[model samples]
Target chain A: MSDTPAGGGAGTRRRGRPPRTESADTRDRILVAAREEFSEHGYEKTSVRGIAKAAGVDSALVHHYFGTKEQIFEAAIAVAFAPTLNAPAAIADGPLDGVGERLTRFIFGIWENPTTRKPLLAIVRSAVNNETAAAVFRRLVAAQLLRRLAEQLGHPDGELRAELAAAQLVGCAMLRYVIKLEPLASADLEQIVARIAPVVQGHLTGP
Target chain B: MSDTPAGGGAGTRRRGRPPRTESADTRDRILVAAREEFSEHGYEKTSVRGIAKAAGVDSALVHHYFGTKEQIFEAAIAVAFAPTLNAPAAIADGPLDGVGERLTRFIFGIWENPTTRKPLLAIVRSAVNNETAAAVFRRLVAAQLLRRLAEQLGHPDGELRAELAAAQLVGCAMLRYVIKLEPLASADLEQIVARIAPVVQGHLTGP
Candidate 1:
């Protein structure tokens, strides 16, 4: 493998160093530990050392895998939100007219599955509680998810449109899944889709 | 004024005890203390003694005024959200067809003002982080704001419709004000209303 930098600079020294197997297994182990530590202690309380301890790895290894607590939180979010990364594809594959229902259904489907919902609640709760965590969440949702969704929109205000639609769905998730507000929380899934799908479509394709 | 108990009952005894001027001034001071305590120490770390100390009152006085920590949080939220209590009136006083724009504009108007929005941020942050705080926040929003708005809608699903609309605005607040996400956060007020008011209307009156 070429550890050779095309042009030698400050970056070259780090690149020239041998990879210490920031391998998939090692990364996953660290991320799982990070998630557990975050869940048990919250963002303010969780530490890199604590996460390393949980992962049964040295503190240096944790830092090597992820640079900071915020970065680690971002990494954990990326994994938890992995299924949603497929969402833009779903929109692109569908007929433009049907994008609304498809996108709405797709998002709700992720939350309907308990496996996805729990971690989402954790990250969302973190985002609400801490600015550093919110910044990571904001960057990930924008860079990874919403930007693609915006591109699929194909409008002058595509970015705005995507965010508007996101605000709608995010609100639903907060009330239904997180806060569990009555009536909306207890409402049938179909009932929500029937009402909300058009709004999603409108935000995507409407004024 | 007569502290008269017409009937000898458990509730009557409490009613017969003269009002200690749970008067506006005393009540306001206790709530200010509560908000300050919750803001400084957060929900878990804050205590009745802390609030009472901060208010320069006895713990018993704090109990007499608000009953418990959760109750104090509720009272604080109620005070913070007082401006919005007038909101149902905004929907009621306006023409039925224009309810969406008026309602959206009115809600945003409250948030637009820093005076009202700061305490709102405090209470909402508390709600997201603490279940006990969340419960108080939920109960007040439901009872004070949404219920009245639901009545104005006059639909079979008026309660559901009201909740759905609340979710929409709440999500925007989370993203725009709380998370401060791009585009949506920077988007002009009218732009939001133009896009969101119709969606809000659709929730209220649409099929």
Candidate 2:
């Protein structure tokens, strides 16, 4: 709560205290507003003031919760991609064969979900347009997530193979969701899985 | 050139009309400028005036050469992707087995060249950010180019297969060029060709 400090400290307290949950609630609201603003206007145009207005908070509170715009944008990407960020761990470690299917199912399933799709789309669109957003996106996706998957394979060229696999899915997302290219855009999910899964499997385990 | 276009009627021209090649050169310069502006500022923020300024021409000339910003954007896409737009013909009426190799070689070959890479990057980036740009990009890539490749394959789910193949390549382009992700970006073109050609071949000719 804004009014209460974890420990009694000078310049940390106010007369009235709000619940800890209330502070989290405010943070969530600001994050939601930030996502919307970033998605719509992208990184360059979005400002803390605009997000604060949208969240019905003072600009100072946005800075308090998230130190800077870059920090806020990073937080937004983390939240949006949180569903898939843990995906490398989702694949059961064993035979290398079906990693592709599990990976595709998890990644595409998140995109297919209406609730997650909205924020993911915003983050993607923002990343594509803004260099700062793209840098953060690249680090999360390439450095953190896919590279981890590559390491799990324990194969030579694991990183390259992992990236190629990622490329296929990212490309699929770019078309099916972002650009909404036809056929792929309208293709049945099972059909997509059937068609693409082997190719992914090949990338992961192929010589 | 600027003087000649203003009040010329019935073949009456100004004192030293630029050569036909000069006119073509001017048009090419404008296209280059449009690509840069669109890529940098995106479709919504990029203006004909900005493009003209970048090209060192009057805004009126941009309108004259390419009526609207949309038309200019379309022209930019055409110029940028021209190498790959006709790629189905480049593969010849060969066995489906190597069609993937030929296609990959042709598609990635364009990106490898510094000349074409600039505009292609612009179009790809703009498409990722702007809906209108994406629509135009989708039509050019899907309807004009890729769908035709699918038709040539004459396989059941030919379009789907074609798009899957495209997704592989497009995804590679996104990572290697646009996002510049890790080893893929710096990987030898031949190495990329060796690695991805089979996956593309699989998507195209695989049962």
Candidate 3:
């Protein structure tokens, strides 16, 4: 049996590492490194070894934490989308009539958060560059985020409507934050949400 | 000064070389080579020498044709967007009431065209991956395409609305063609356009 951490040995416990209090910390470290690597090099070029190296851990340790590169990437994206995903529920708890304003505000607030925005930019950039990254991004948007948004709206074509809403929101982010187009780029977040939210709301609940 | 082709020296012209014709051919060749190079290797990895080699021309010829890599990329994108730029006019000439169908057909036609689609995929991929590429793409979309669509629509918020329409079209393309998601990936073009065009036209014409 090979002594390497990644290679499983006969009669050895499948879970090699004993549970540690710092398990979450190690997982987060791997995620951070993966985000940076994926952002800079994209999915096709980014390797597990490379992420492991960046995280200052053995490749096997990375596998121990995330299992595979795709799994790690999914986890990273889940984390990235969490704020937006959770926002709808939070906004729903508020006034239903002001859903548009609340939704837009929630979106802009999350995007304006630097910690969230930077990793998101990386994911967005990487997704555009590589097919694999794009697939992951699309899945998250379609399955998790858009699906939830559609469920909230409860329209007949809610899925499609939700996707359109997402496209508008994401497209604005792409231009303002990632691409940094003029005028729109410099516009205040509040101004943007105020202007655009109605359109999003119309899509969500219009006839 | 320097005798290199890129330097544009004032020395005696070569006899019987047909400088103008050769230069034009070189420029076209470089653009073609650049499209393929950028598509395959992306903007960062593609080089002038590599493009020149692909074109079977001298490196100096590439520089002479296009001043820099950035200029070449811009030219390539301009070429890619050309199909869409002319599309509005073509669709405009058709029945005004069926503008949505005409527009949808035109967009799907271009995206379905293998010749155009490959380079487009490259451009989109690069734009998503690299900041420079994203900036260039955003500028092209904003200035040329979105502005024209807005002008044609003659809406009060034409610019923003046009951008919103563009986001729908581009986002769908990104998912169907680039990401190759289920259902959308295999769905018939007519069905997709039928479903999507009204939404797009709504953004353009408004109720």
Candidate 4:
């Protein structure tokens, strides 16, 4: 609620030099702040002003960069899944025989990173109960990842197959990272990839 | 805050005689009431009094029957997963080769039931964001189901394998039911079973 600035404004303009576009660093800071806020307080309780304050920028700047809370949330999801958003392309480069392994490795690889896991865990946790958050998460997965992959597969029920594949991976992530269910939570990475790859391969290549 | 008796205590003592045990009908009524209250308001917001009111009983009766909200929540999870808790046995009754189909069919069967699905969804949704609910839900899955299944597998990384298998099915359920991701949401039952059963079987029987 306070009209606080994210940065001192002095730091952003200390050189008194104008850049052609908004500083990427500033925008990045806002995104990071938004992610933290949304993860902690959830979608409903988080406010742009709160995010701006945490980001050390004015609320107007947050507004200018991301129009609405929904927009900011979408951006957060995009950032969280950024590494794997183009997973279809990554899996395509791989042979069909090992597509499951490649896809499993790629998706889990992003999830294994501490840097990305935090926001993702938060989003997954929130999306479980909140429809709006789920919608954004669903849109990204269906549009950017799964459906894109499904289109490339010239098979019957490709969409359903693609989703089943996604479901397996999503479920694994849910249990391993989000729920931290025993054994799976502490299982070695290569071990999981070894077991799950074939299932994914089946979903991708199977009729 | 209101003092109310469940079922007017009339059905239990129509002959004006005390019963040997708590009325099964009364206990069942409270459970149904608890499920609705917890689903709608979530764990923290749901109170004994509220549940009692919904069941048309006194808050003291809720406490007398269930001890605490946590206990009641645990009962709810148990009831929701009853069909699948002994899934190993259910699957065992069938051929090992078709175990995946049996398992998948069993879990989805429970999920498809409207009576069970409502409370299960609430618990699953609540568990995502709420640690306490998650813990209760987790305990039931780990101890009663997945871990039990793992113990019987007697394979290398058996527990992890069991969980990965669970992740596949759970993830599918989350997307199809909880998140309601489409194509998946509308996909035919046998089709999904055909696709997912192999993955589940692979996890169970594979190395």
Which predicted model would earn the best DockQ? 4
Chain A TM-scores, all candidates? 0.85, 0.86, 0.84, 0.85
lDDT of 3 by residue, A1-207 (tens): 122444344555335654333566577788889888876777778899999999999999999888888888888778877787786577667655677778777877778889888777777777776667777887887777767777887787777666555555766676677666555677667766765676677666766
What's the DockQ of model 1?
Answer: 0.58
lDDT of 1: 0.82
Model 2, residue pairs in steric clash: none
Instruction: Note the residue pairs that clash in candidate 1.
Output: none
**Would you list the clashing residue pairs of candidate 4?**
A6-A56, A6-A57, A7-A56, A171-B171
**Which ten-residue region of model 3 chain A has the weakest summed lDDT?**
A1-10
Error of 2 at A158 (Å): 1.8
Give the distance in Å from residue B4's predicted Cα in candidate 2 to where it truly belongs: 9.1
- What tens digits encode model 1's per-residue C-alpha lDDT throughout B149-197? 8888789789889888877888888899888889989999889999889
lDDT of 4 at B204: 85
* lDDT (Cα, 0-100) at A195 in candidate 2: 81
Which residue runs of candidate 3 sit more than 4 Å off their true CA positions? A1-20, A94-101, A155-157, A188-191, B1-22, B91-105, B153-157, B182-207
Per-residue lDDT of B48-117 in model 3, one digit per residue for the tens?
8999899998888777767888888899878877887776687767655676667778877889999878
Cα displacement (Å) at residue B3, model 2: 12
The Cα error of candidate 1 at residue B205, in Å, is 1.4
2 or 3, greater by lDDT: 2
